[model samples]
Target: MTALEIKEYIQKNGKIPYVLESIGCSNIVYHDNKDYYSCSNAVGGDCNNPAAINIRNNKYLNYRNYTRGVEYDDGKDLISLVQYNKNIDFANAMKYLHKLLGLKNLYKVKEEKKKPDDSWFVFSRFVVKRRKCVVNDFDPMSEDILNDFVPYIHIDLFREGIIKRTIKKFGLGYSYRWRRTIFPIRYWLDGTLMGYNARSSIENCSEFGISKYFITPGMRKEINIYGLWENYKDIQKAGYIVIFEAEKSVLKRDSRMDPTGGAIEGHVLSDEQVRIILGIGVEEVIIAMDNDVPIEEVWNMCEKFYGLRKVSYIRDKWKLLGPKDSPADAPNKIYNFLFKWRIPYDESKHREYLKSLKKNS
Candidate 1:
């Protein structure tokens, strides 16, 4: 059946929770008053502390497997939930759902329409030529372009424990027109201007329909590592690197943790980023994502550098961090303590430790 038909069928029949159970999800518990059901994460198996995954009104699914750094905050439909949990493409997921529901996998057919003709193109000389449009690649911006922003520091950075020296060191700027703080993104190997990340300074900016971050068009934050330009030497000298989620986390740390760098955009590292880190020749990799990120997710990141480098991670097992706090968000002593006691990544040991914590709790 078509995607919409399958979705409607599941919701109308109240089969979302049943689908979860069918897909190997265990410990399914429904909340009578809230009209929702909670279950252990489908991917990680049943947890003594269940509720990492939930379904609301049998239509929307919310799954947060922090250990895996996988979260579906916005509710997902049954098809999407199946696709994600089962690691299958849309067609296969639909087919699986059909099988589970005891239905046939009959796809909807499209109405016939006139097709475009591409046999030949009339040119000035009556030649059969198909013109190909070549898109231009974006060139790197220059440091001189930063002159556009005012050379003034915003108070928000300071409130976040960013010192004046670090601000000036990074050449932070302010945009008068946009009312935002400007952060210049640069190439890591050689300091060349790449783009600017403009952060909204206005309080409750989202309420006013202003986005928190406005990055430069054509800027691929995924491929590059922020602060790598400034901290590459430190990372090499220290024999390890600490990877954080946000750029500010890299700037707010003790200068000693100069080896720390931020993932330009997200908690997950891209293939190119992993390659770059491997090329850096560091002996150890410390995945120090934010507190909200589960150790399981961090452990998954460790797989990238599994045998190539010694992998370790910082987790708030002692309850030092807030719900969404970064290790760098804490004071120097706390950050240092967490860093010093970072757990070395061992698949078997980590799983056992997680089980132990669940058992004790």
Candidate 2:
């Protein structure tokens, strides 16, 4: 059957439960006289009723209690709903539905178009709005103030010796008046301090309805990856870069950079960022995200870098390790895994890995 024919059948039949069941959605239940299906992929398996599609009206009320209702029309709308709920792309959604219906070759699913270059968007929204630097207004704090703040700020990091090293290596400082620890964010090209990210020292600030993290006025954290400037030389020397999700994770694991803030679902590598990495002659990229990060996210990242660079990821072996744990927690184990997989660290090894990747491809 064609996609249009299948869609028409579903619309006419008006059996939401059957359609959901065909896709292996168990735990289907009737609530409030409406058929609600819970997606296994949903965190905690608590699919809200609003995400349910109404068979009678042929409309998907996705989070309708909070958002507007999206009417289900053709297969495209169904694909969209599946993408929204399952966290997969349109093509994958189509493939999944088709396979479930035992009609694998029924539809020709067009791939989603890539977004336009975001460099200009980022620059206009972030760079142009950056506050002018006042001469001698925001210098680093004095040693005496820093020493006093060190005890209150990241005590665990201080104990582990990472805090002092990060301060020395990245020229991090404490702002006495601001009551924040400042980490200078630099430009990758010239290592110039373009802005700084200030983290509050007060542990309960967030609990008390305060912002724990603050960026320089008009600085968009999403546009730039943290630690990229400081670690670019090491990344070039290593021929591969290890990417983490948090700036603290980068510091803990000695990773090259974290994605602006953290990984978002279905986040793709921006063209501008990819160009910069490629320009730097990075041969491979290893995503070493936290254990709780979904495998789908890892696959999404791999797909973004596919054919452009050799991409691999570190698999979490220990279930006890929480999302906040970094490679520094078990450096020896991570190193052993790298060695076993022959992840490149030097020029010759990089060439070998590239050849192997190409062969496999």
Candidate 3:
């Protein structure tokens, strides 16, 4: 689609039945070997195929991409992008997120000025070396890796397929809050298959009160967001993303949060993650954390990096609907409040909103 055609051709999918259908969401369950993914029906597949989302060399944290100033995927809690690169700033941010997550040095990589046609910096780690999912229509993994490399207790959204069945056939699997059969998998931003994060189900983890859900030995939440690369543009266009506390938030129909794993919700940003934000060249960053604890502390942190001018907050009004630990008490209600944000970014409106919250509190 041409740049002009995007406004018309930018296809969109409204609510569809959550089932495996090629016409719907390219559903299947089986691997094609040669590192190509094996897919299956979620009804018969393992819990969910865990694609090895190799930030490969990049890094991530809480789902926000700093380098390109965009959110990556639609799922809110995914690992950094391994397969495809979207939004240059986001891909670049993931690289630094990797570093920030302690997957690499603390420094986020600096963005260099380049032509649009220049090698998209996001692909540098794998494109030149031909790592998994870097090649289009080329599956570069083994069934063993597909079945034994990924862990999903932290990152939830699963892709549909047989791998998802494998988990359920035996009685255990995390359904992708969004997307398809999870098993070990990977893909590019254009939605091409890249690689998978396959893993063994937690066969015996109840003793420590640990759910039997299996996870890789070393996947770190401090290191990456689950599916950031997929939703980079929306984040940029939206100018801000509403961070959620749980990975499941990405799957459920909650407008207050990013179903794409792009929102940044947590206690605070690490120094490295903070630095990653600068790397992206973002002029504004509105901290939209849930009003769980000290908004003041969070405010201090925001001021440290983005300044009071760029910060914004969504006062936790979970009580507006009912008593609970979620905005789910009234998802639509919360969403309606945020919907007004879709308009252009105006300073006066943000101030009014903030002042109103302060008076109410």
TM-score for predicted model 2 compared with the true structure: 0.48
For residue 258, what is the lDDT in candidate 1? 55
**What is candidate 2's CA lDDT for residue 212?**
79
Question: Which candidate number has the best TM-score?
Answer: 1
Residue 329, model 1: lDDT of 87
lDDT of 3 by residue, 230-266 (tens): 4445555655544444433333422234432233335
* Overall lDDT per candidate, in order of appearance: 0.67, 0.49, 0.34
Runs in model 1 deviating more than 4 A are 1-138, 254-259, 347-361
Ranking by TM-score: 1, 2, 3
**TM-score (all chains, Cα) for each model:** 0.58, 0.48, 0.39
Cα error, candidate 3, residue 56 (Å): 30
Q: Which pairs of residues have clashing backbones in candidate 1?
A: 66-294, 67-296, 67-297, 68-297
lDDT string, candidate 2, 1-361, tens digits: 3233445555556555566555444455545455433333233243444344433324432212112244433212444555556766433554566566555443333323334445633212223323333211221212222333333335545554455555566667665655676666665544545565667777789787768777656543443456776776677667777666656655655532222122211134554344345444466877666666665555555545566678676666545355755444445566446424632233454455567667668
Which residue runs does candidate 3 get wrong by more than 4 Å?
1-208, 212-215, 253-266, 278-284, 321-324, 338-361
